[model samples]
Structure formats: C-alpha cells, structure tokens
Target: MSADRSSGGGVSRRQLFGVLGAGAAGAVVGAAGGAGVALAATGGGTTDASGAAASVYPYFGAHQAGIVTPAQDRLHFAAFDVADALDREGLIGLLTEWTDAAARLSQGLEVAEGGAVGGSDYSPPTDTGEALGLPASGLTITFGFGPGLFTDESGADRFGLSARRPAMLEPLPRFQGDALVPEMSGGDLCIQACADDPQVAVHAIRNLSRIAFGRASLRWSQLGFGRTSSTSTTQATPRNLFGFKDGTANVKAEETAIVDDHVWVHASDEPAWLAGGSYLVARRIRMIIENWDRVQLGEQEMLVGRSKGEGAPLSGGTEFTEPDFDKTGATDAPLIDADAHVRLAHPTSNGGARMLRRGYNFVDGNDSLGRLDAGLFFLSFQRSPQQFIDVQTSLARDGLNEYLKHVGSAIFAVPGGVAEGEFVGQALFA
Candidate 1:
C-alpha cells in the first residue's frame, strides 16, 4: 500500500533514460560476476528462492510480459474497438504512446513524466492516482489484435493492411453450448492487465484507457478475482467455482520444449510479423450454480472424471497422476466416462494439442432470478488457433456442458514483445 520511491521520486521522461542506462550497466556488471545483480537497475525488490514477497517480470523482452508469466491473483481485461477516424498514422501513434505508458506502469512507475499530482492543477491528471503508492505487485500488461482490426464487418480492409492479417486470427466458431451475447463477443483490440493487488490492475487499465481516448473506445470489460489456473510448476493448482481442481494438465512454464512447440508461433506460421507471437482464445463460461449445486456428489464426480475432494482421477491416483482412460469399473464400463470433461479435453485424445491456460473466477452480483451471475473468464494461449478449435469442438459432448454456458468469446493474435526502442506490433506496421 506504500509507494516505493527507492530509486528516486517524481521521475521525468528525461530521467527514465538515465535510469535505463544505469540498468544496462548493472546488467553488464552482473554478467561479469557482480555481487547479487538485480533484474533491472530500477532496483525493484528481489525475493528469496521461495519467490514470496517480491516477484517482478521485466516489461521489455522477447515475448510480452503476461503470457507465460505466472498468473496473478486479480485481473482487469478490457477490449476496445478502434475509432474509424484513426488512420494508420494516428493508430500507430496511439500504440507507441500506449507502449511507453505500459512500460512505466509495469515497472511500478507513473504513466507520465509528472505523474498524478505533479501535473498542472488546471488540467486533468495524466496518471490516475489510485495506485499512486503501490509496488508493482508483479503487474503485467499484455496486448492483442482482434480480427476486426484488420477488416470491418462488411469485409472492407479498413486498415489497408488486411493482407497482413494472420491466417489464424479469425472469429471463433460457435460451440454446441454457446449462448454468446453480441456485446461481449468481439473486439478490435484487447489489453489484459493482471497483478496481485486489484487496485494495481485496475489502475493500469484506467491509465491506458485514458491514453487511448481518441483512438479507441472500450467495447466491454471484465474484472476477475481468484485465479483458477497455475502457469508455472512453482505455483499450486487453484480450484474453480465448481469446486473441482482446474487446469490440472495445463502447459507449465517450466516445460520449455512443450512451450516452444505448442505456444510460440514460428517464422513459417504464415504472418511473418507474428513469428514469436501466440494466439489467445478467451471464453466467458457461466456455470449454472443452482443446477450444479443440486447435482449428486457421485454424479458431479462422473461429470468431471475426477474426485471432488482430492481432484484425483476416478480410476485412482494423485492429483497429478495421468488419467487412465482404459480402466474399467465393476460394471465393466470405462471408469472415466467418455463424455467426462477431463476425458474429452485431454491432450492424448486431442492430437497432443495443448494451451497455456491463465483463467480467473468472476462474479458480477446477481441475475434477474437472483442467482449469482458468475463464471470463469477462461483465457488460453497457443501457437495456433486451430489447436483451440479442435479441442473445443471435441468438447461438444462433454457431460459438464449441461451445467455450463459459453456466454462470451473472442480471439486475438498477440504479437511478440517490444524491444527497447520499438513499440508493440511495430514489425507488423513496418
């Protein structure tokens, strides 16, 4: 809750360069065996081997900060539609501005040179003051481009760069249990800001939205709490609203080979600009709480193909045990039902396709009937969009489908990270 001004307070644009220069010097010295080198000379807090209090992911790197980064506890996901008035040049300018702001914010610094109160009293504050005195809290901001950004509804090349659109960056197909609401479905651009503290995440999005005023308008936004998946082996698996362990088979960050093969796109993957990027698929899956809570314990176990308590496969084993799909019960039937969620969604059954999931549980008050309007804001990243499509298509027969409805969905082509002097998606614009 306290502001960290360890490096120095009230930094200007000019001061940032000096700070970065020092950081580079520190990196060089660290490579030459300095005593305990920091990740960046900004002097962000360092944690012990346990990674307990201080964990910071650098903003500028080969890949964006949030994708493979460990999941944060809170989320602020906002989607925007580019303004028709913004031509190519204007759009690029906005992106450049956003990149600078994101970099500063992610490093636990103010969005602008003067920050919130340092600006003129007569003008609106450049930086929102909500997270004024907060640490980075492991904040990470990720950007993506939706299909509509390339072409309009009528299929006109609005941006004059439609030919550059990645082949995998298209609208998601309707699934069997989809009850999609148009307002929450598609967007021209998206930004996902996550952090351990809710205020930090919200503040990041608020400042970005302010910076994007003339170029993009918010389509819809969702605030999520209680992450439901673990992205790294260092973290423990978290449960979803249904009370069953989720993302048990998720692609972990430690699995470098699998991450490279299934998550990051290659140079030969059609759109050259998106070579190191990845595809993101988001689904707002609403669980029918009243109905699901009424189901019998045994029935719920059957639906998920795992134990409700330990989250172990019904065939028997620990939580991380590979599910034995061939095991038969006393009645001579397959132990894990063919329509069970785990069975249908497993990689072994889906051509070895996998996605790095970073989902969070959401609750939005209540519905008209007084039932809680809540669900999982399911988010996943993969090398190819088809990998997600194939898996979702196979889940059409999942028994869990009866108690769930896909209310909102979107897909975005997230380009690779920005280099020190470059803006996000700069390669595509070039």
Candidate 2:
C-alpha cells in the first residue's frame, strides 16, 4: 500500500476513509462486492480492523495487476501501434510515463500535480476532470507487448526485440469459423484498464492515449460492462451475453497451485524476462443473439450442456459439479452432447489445458443490419499460447459456435510486474 508521491500528492487519509465507508455501505446494500470489497475490506484499503472506505492496489508488484486481481465491473481495453519514428528509448519513456500515471490512478489520484484545472488555462489540463471526485474503485491497469512490437507482418524486427521474443509470443493462428476483421486483430501494445466505474476505466485509457499521442496511436478499443467471469472464489459466477453462467471452472486467485501450473510461465519455458509472466489472448466474439433467442429452450440447454436456470450440468448436479461427460440419457446418447460448449471447452476434453478467463459482456449499439453488435470481450491469461489454441481447437466443433462469430483477435506477452523503480516490460528492452 505504498503511495506514489512523486506526482500528484498522495491520497489523503480522509479520502481513503471516505471511499471505504461508501464501499462498505454499498456492499451491505448489495450494490457492490468482488473487486470493490477486495479493495475496501482487505489491506489494500485504508480502513483499520473495523473497516472504513479506502481501497487501492499497489501499482508495482511481482505480477501485473488486473489478471489475478478480482475482476472489476467495467473494462476499457485498447491496443496501440507504436509510431514508426520512435526508437527504443522513446518507447521506454512512454512505458515509464504510463506506469507513473497508472500508479496515481489506482490510488484515486489525478495524473499529475495541479490535476485538471490545477494547470494554467493557457495550457492543456494535466488530468481529465471527469473522475475528479470519484474513489479509486479498485482500478487496475495492465500492460502487454504484442508480437507486432517485436516484428512486423513483413518479419522485419521493429525494436531490436526479435531475438528476445518468446516462442509463445507469435500471432495466433486463424481458427476454424473465425470471421476476424483485419483492423481489429493486432497491435504492438495493449493496455487493459478495469474499474468498478465505467467512467473511471474510460478516463484511465483516455489519458494514457493522450500521453501516447506522438509515440503510439490507438489501433482499436473496446468498452465492456458486467464481467462475465469471476477470478476469485469469493465472487459469484457471472453470465455472458447468452444469459448462462460462464467460467465456472475458471482458475481462481485462491488456487495457487492451479494458477502457477496453468497460468504463469516458468523460467525454462522461454525468454528469461517472462519467467513470472503469462500470455494473454483477446478475442471479440460477436454473439448472434437474435438467432440464439429463436432456438427452443431445451435445445439451448443441450447446446450449452447445462441447465439454463441453475447452470448445472445436464447429468444432474449443482453449478460447480464435476461434469460427467460419460453420463447417458434415455436414448443412450451422451447426456451432455459431444459438441456442447461446456463439454468441448472443458479441460478434460482438452488434455487438461486451462486458461484464466477474465472476460466481460459488451453491447456496441447496432450493426449495419440494425441488429445489436454485442458479444463477450474474451480475455484470458495462460502459461502458454498453445494452451488456448488447444482448447479453442476443441471448441471449433462445438454447437455453440453456430451462435457466435470471432470478429477480432490478438495475443500479447504480459511481462512480470515491475519493481518500485522499474517500468512494465522493462526486461524486454534490457
């Protein structure tokens, strides 16, 4: 809980108390929990044993924030293409600036001294004013380096990073039934900002984008609300756009063994700098809601291999029941369809491979046909990109594929968290 006092003044004790009090009251009324509670109730917040209102995650850590952190309610994910004119030092400076700004933001402070109006009217504001009075809201900003940062499509090294690229950092292969859009598919860098308030999340990204003006340009951005997966055992499983509970078996932060085994990269796995890091796979899967809604309820259940109401396996058990893929129904057909989403995507079916999912549901107005352009902004972290490929490959034959189309995809190498004096991805440059 060390404060970054270098820029904006450290968060006041009163401000911290205020946030904790409000968070506790909200949690009591069922309006807040998960990341909100994690921030306020845990040591991250300023509250003492009795619980008061300040919550903040340290910006510097062993692993990046937002991945294992409890999933926040809103997300503003953006990918950026580094300016061709910038050299290695310029990129490092950008990362340093982003790290400093992120530290202040996570503590609910402005981006710089004399935030917003504190600066002279003749010059641009140091911080955007929208989140002036807001609490930190458990905001976490995570950074990642994509394959394109190391080398371009033409295979030319871009930043003298080609030799350091981890084998798992290559572009994701086009999967069957993918409808990826070229413009939305890749970038040299990515930043994932998650917060309890949508405005807070957006503000973080906006200011970061502004700071990167000449060095990096946003390639594509997505706004997501209502997380679809729970990263902590304390959180209730949330639903996807389809209304079924999602990520029931996802790796939880409490599962230390599972996380280390399935999520974090080992030293021997690749380039040394990424030893404690992980690979991230992002996919914008557009859900065909209209078509899915037309299907019969029973068929929908069959396709998902779980009860619509309780989200239990069709074989009969609670939501967290270990699915019995071998169970048989009256007709002797497997109780869970062989191609059912849950069945196909299960670790048992994918050679015990698993990824930590932190996805969110998104609704982006309407498409050209006037249909809702909505789906899940699928985000997952894994020890190796191959783990995602294997599970996704198995899901290619799933019945659920008919109701969704993969419109965008990208993969990034998430380096280990930074020490107090270092910036994110500093190892790659070294």
Candidate 3:
C-alpha cells in the first residue's frame, strides 16, 4: 500500500512503468513504522532461490507466464463479459490498463501508483489493500480471448475482430455426458490468476475485476486449491479430489520439443497473431463423491487404471513407468481395461494429442442433499482446440465418467505474451 510515484490521483501509462521499475527497489516498511522488511520478503525486488523474494515471477515475456511457469498451488479463474456499449478503442484501453496492472502485481507491487493509503483522502483507494504485506508468491496473471470477444452469439462482429479470430477459436462442441451449466460456460474474455498463497491469487482477481468496473463485468469465477497436476519435473505429481494421481504423463516444461510440438501454436498455423500462444480448455468436472466413496479400493483403482497409492499403471514399474496397454493378465484380459480412464485418454487412443494440464482440486461445500460439492477444475493448454477435442472424444465411454459430471466448460485463445512496453494481445489489435 505504499506510494511509488507522485502523490497524484491517477497514473498515466508512461508513469506506470516508472513506478514498476523503481517500486521493486524500495524497502517495504511496515505501516506502523516498525522495522523495514527485506526487499526479498516484501517486493522491493526479487532474488535467487536462496532468498524469500525468489517467488516473484516476471510478468512480461515472449510467452505468457502462467502456461509453463510451474503451476502454482492456488488459482482464481474468472470469465468476463465485455460491455456491449464499448467500442474497439475502449476495449484497447482496457487491455492496456490490464497489462500495466498485471506487470506491477506480478512483481509484488500495488496495482496503481498511490496504492491503498497514498491516494487522496476523499477518493477511494487505488488498491484494495488486502495483500499489503504479502510477497509475490510466484504470482502469474494470464489473459485469453473467448469466441464471443470477436463475434457475438448472434454471429454479429462486435469489434471488427471476427475477421481476425482464429479458425480454432470457436465454442467447444457438446460432448456426451456433459451436464454443463449455461451461466458458467462462456465469456468474452478470461483471466487465470495463480499464486502459492490463495490470498495473493484472490487479490489479483479482485483488483482486476475492480479495474474492469465499467468496460467489462465478471460473468463467473472459480476458486481452486491443491493443484492436481505438475507442469515441471521438479515438482511431484499432485492428486485430484478422487485421490488418484492426475496428469502423470502430462507434458513437462523441460520437454521443450513436446511443448513446441503440442503446446504452443506455430507460425505455420492460421491467425499468425497467436503463433507463440496456445489454446486453453477448461472443464469443471464435479465428482460424485458420495458414490465414489462407497466403491471398493480395488474397484477405484480399476476405474483409474493405476494403483491408488503409487499411481503406477497396472502394467507399470513405477509412477513414471509407461503403461503397457497391450499387457494382459492371467484371465486373458488386458491389465488396463479398454474403457479405463487412463487407457481411453492416452495419446495412443487420441492420435498423439497431448495436453499440458494444470488442474486443481476444489470443494465448494456440501449440497442440499448433503453431498460434497467437490471436483477437479480441469485446465489444459494445447497447440489447438482439436487436440483437446480428439482426446475428450476418445473418452466418451471412460469408466471414470460414471463417477464424474462435466458441470462447466469453456475454451479461449490465449495470445502470446506481453513484450516490454506493449499491452497483451497487441499483435491482434495492431
């Protein structure tokens, strides 16, 4: 909540960057005038792994930060509907302001120059002041454009962007067994905020939502914790709410070849503005917790096609071992069932369509019927929407689907990243 710039009411784009650069170098002093906190601990600047400030991640890069930046422990995913009255220039201005705010937030600074207390006494505070003393905690804010951002549901071009829309940016086709909620499905734009601390993640979204006051309004949002997948080999595979290791064979950031092939869009792809970006497929899969709890351990393992404890495939040597889909048991049946979740969603079953999953477990509280309203917020990024479609289509008869329901679904075309001094999606606007 410290002021890094002039004691003015608002910041111009030119002045915002000045604050971003210098704000990190200033020591974070306690509001009570107590001892100053180290720069590494409270956002004066970031440091190496040896220091507490190592958690801070840079906001600007060639590719967006959240996609492969080692999935954080917490998430606040929000979808926004742009105002129908806003014009193209107004939308551009919103993105420009968002870019400036994201850069400052990721670096552990406040959203605006004066922040919470440094602004005018009569006016409202710039920042919400909830995350005042917190470190960045590896914060990352990713932005994406949904199909409606270009063309409305009625097929009318809203901002002359229908022509620029990627052919692959359309709404996802209905999948079998999908009981999706309409209110939770689509949006004109989306933001994925992640951090090690849940408060930090929530703060990012809360402030951004506030910033979108007039030009855009939040449609729906999901809060998730306990990441279900790991994006890097350095991290251990996390479990889903079902107690099974998820995304064990997910593409890792270290696998640059696989990432380039299956995750990032290429120059050869259409809509060159998104060449370095990727497509995001988000599914809110609600778990039938009460029903699944009644199933025997062996049956649970059978459905998932892996050991409940080790997460190893039935024909595997360890957690990281490859599944021998063809391996048979003494009963002359395949060790991994034909309709098992693993077998059905495997690359071999989906034409080598791989995804970088950054899923998370969520428990929204018990329902009126006393069932736990919990499930996995399935999030994956791929080169094209077809990659997800092919895999999801292959899982039509997945045995695990019996204990799960697809409650919410959305897809967005995430642009590359923000270059220094440029707003996000600048290529598309240009």
Candidate 4:
C-alpha cells in the first residue's frame, strides 16, 4: 500500500486505527489533530439528517478522526443482513449505497457520491495486520457478521427491503429465520460509534443514523457502545463483560506475517479507483463483567491466558510481554495449552492471521444497579472471515465463552481508496 492512503478511495493506513504514532515502535495511535482528515476539495460543508456532518471517516470521507483513545474517541462496529437480504448482489448494492450516502454526506465537497462497481471475482479478505502497524490507540472500524443474518420468519420483514413491513416481526433482527431478541448475535443493521466524549460520539452517530435511515429506508437498528475508562488503569489491557483482557494477543500492525497474504486482497488485483484503502467496522458485544468477577481468578486466567489484574500469561510474563508458549507450568503441568483463549488468540498459530483489537469500557445504568455496562464492542477487521472465524470459533467454546455472548454483528465490504475520482463502491448502487 502507498504511504498516504488518506488522500483517496478508502481510508489510508495512517488514518485508521492502531494508527501507529509517528515512530518505529509503531505503538497504536489515533487521529491526534486536524479538521477531520479532509478529502480533496470536491464540494462544500454538508449536513446530515440531524444536521451534523453527513458522514464520518472509515465509511464517509466527511471527517478524519484525529486520534484514538481509551476514553472512547470514535465509534467502532459492524452490521449484518438477515439471510433473505444479504445475498451476493444485495450485499453489493447495500455497501454501494452506503458509500454513495457517505459521498452525498460529503456533498461533492470531497468526492462525487458513488460511481463504480466491483467485479464478481475471487479475492482475499482485508489485512488487519496492517492496522496493528499503524498504532494501538486510535479510532478504527471493523465489520463481521454471524451466519444467521440471512434468515427471516413468516410475515417478518427481517430483510427490511420487503414491500410489506411485517407486523409479527416485533421490531427485531432475526437468526435462523426466527424472531430475534434485542440482543441478537448478528444484526441486520449494526452501528457502533466511539469518541472520547460519550456525548460527542452519540451526537455524531445520531446524525449519521438519520442519514442512513433516510437514504436506505432502513427501520430501527441495534446500537452498541464500547468505552475506554480513564477511571481505572490498574487493568493492564482493556476488557469486555467476560472480564477477560480481550484482544491482548492478536498481531500488531506493520508486523511481518503471512496472515496478511491470507487475509487481505492486494490493491494490484483490484480496480484502479481503489488503491491504498481498506474497509473497516466494529462490533460492541456487551459482557457481563460483574458475573465474570465472581469466577475464581485461576479459572479466569485459564480462559484469558493471563491474570486479570496484570494481563500477564497465566504461566508467567508481564502485560505486553511475550508469553512462554513452550513453558509447561510444572513437571507434569500443561502450562499454556493450545486451546487456551490467549494461546489461540496468540498470533503465532493459524497462519498468524491475528486481528488487531482496540476497544474501550462503557458504563451506563441507573444508580440502582451501581454497575457499569461494560463489554468490548469487540471491534476488528479482516480481508476475509474464514481465518478469523476459525480462531474465534475455537475460543467460543473455550472457558470464557459463557460469560460473554456474541450480541451484535455487522459486515461491510470496504473498497480500496483511489485518487482520480470518488471513494470506491459509491457509483454502482447509488
């Protein structure tokens, strides 16, 4: 990819998450300054349905997020479609319109809203490894969906495209063609947004949500939140409800790994309009942390591969330190087993297709519960889902799975960013 993907069809590696600070350690970085990364002057100040900027970066080129922080800076997440609507063509059209809307949000001040169509050919998934190389602390988006998104039941308009919005639908997304509860694992409409100031993030999203609803004619959607807490730093790595330090062992961006080839599709193989860009999204899966805290610390470590207090490997090693995968705890002890959560999430195994994770802690509730609504709006990105699924599935049945349920999910095909015209994926569907 080119040095500054920031200028064109998709988000530049620089603008995206774990956006590495301007240094070699390549620690995670977030948009630190500037008037949202500006796209080439193509139009004028725009307004959204709620009168906010029409679109946001990683989806809309309207604003470039300055930096990412645990304080919750930018929204992170993905959305999926019910089986009935997420077919190959439908998926294509959906994103096309999203990008088109983003362009419209740009209002020609950036790139023309929508123009090209991607070819139906075999291609690799996206390379989130590149994301780790950028920086660990920044706002980035990732998209992924569960298998159930495609199903809808009798008289239920889960697809939303239905001519008759079904009454029996009960205003919820579906999985396996059945009516899903509010916390459906995979969502037809998913929107995850984060910002240092919770209110700013919410306001920004309300505008974007309004725009999306207006253009696509979408009904209600599932909104999830991931927050970074400055209140507590004793927790070495961040965590979700399961109380495990989620995403501690994934690969870092800029790290050399074959996983890149396996996950991401190269720009050379795609259309010219798409050059140095990639799609991104995030999912906020709320965790039941209080319940997690009740589990024995030893058992918790077994599930997360580290002590919750230190984020260190259960066998040994400090937070941010390399784990001793080879060390057996005792003469007959199984130290770091292959199936361990941290072990599986470790980048060394599975072609190293480890995803880069940067999420936060959010607290919401009345004084009655005295509890914070915390969980990872588990955010991540990939050129494809196969490998990510492989590793994730293994962890799902692992020790910590029960404490956490996959609540919200979404998937979007991000187009590469090119310069000569508008953002990729805009023209075709619009």
Largest TM-score belongs to which candidate? Answer: 2
Cα-based TM-score, every candidate: 0.89, 0.90, 0.89, 0.55
Q: TM-score: which is higher, 3 or 4?
A: 3
Off by over 4 Å in 4: 1-192, 217-236, 241-244, 254-264, 268-286, 337-339, 360-374, 418-424, 427-430
Residues 63-156, candidate 1: write the lDDT tens digits: 8878777777888898888877778877777778788889999888998877889989976677889988887777889999999989989898
Clashing pairs in 2: 19-53, 20-53, 20-54, 21-53, 45-54
Give the whole-model CA lDDT for all candidates, comma-separated: 0.80, 0.81, 0.81, 0.39
lDDT of 2 by residue, 1-430 (tens): 1223343322345544543332210000011235433432122434233221234677777788888887878889988888777787777778888888888898889987788998888766789889999887778899999998888888988678899988778889889779998677888999999877788888998888777766677788888888888887878888887889888889988777888899988888789889788999999889999999899999999999999889999998999999999999899999999999999999988899999998888888888999988888899999999999999999888998899999989999999888887778887777
Query: What's the lDDT for residue 136 in model 3?
Result: 86
Model 4 CA lDDT for position 60: 37
**Model 1 whole-model lDDT (C-alpha atoms):** 0.80
RMSD of each: 9.7, 8.1, 8.5, 14.9
What TM-score does model 1 achieve against the real structure?
0.89
Per-residue accuracy of model 3 over 1-430 as CA lDDT, tens digit each: 1112222234455544533332211000000011112232122324455343347777777688888777778889988888777788778878888888899999889998889899889887999999999888778899999999999988989888899999988889988779998777888899999877788888998888777766677777888888888777767778887888877898877788888899999989999999889999988889999999999998898899999999999987899999999999999899999889999989999889899998888888878999988888889999999999999999899888889899889999999978887888988977
lDDT of 1 at 63: 81
- Clashing pairs in model 1? none
Compute the lDDT of residue 320 as modeled in candidate 4.
69
**How high is the lDDT of residue 30 in model 2?**
12
Residue ranges of candidate 3 with Cα displaced over 4 Å: 1-54
Instruction: Name the lDDT of candidate 2.
Output: 0.81
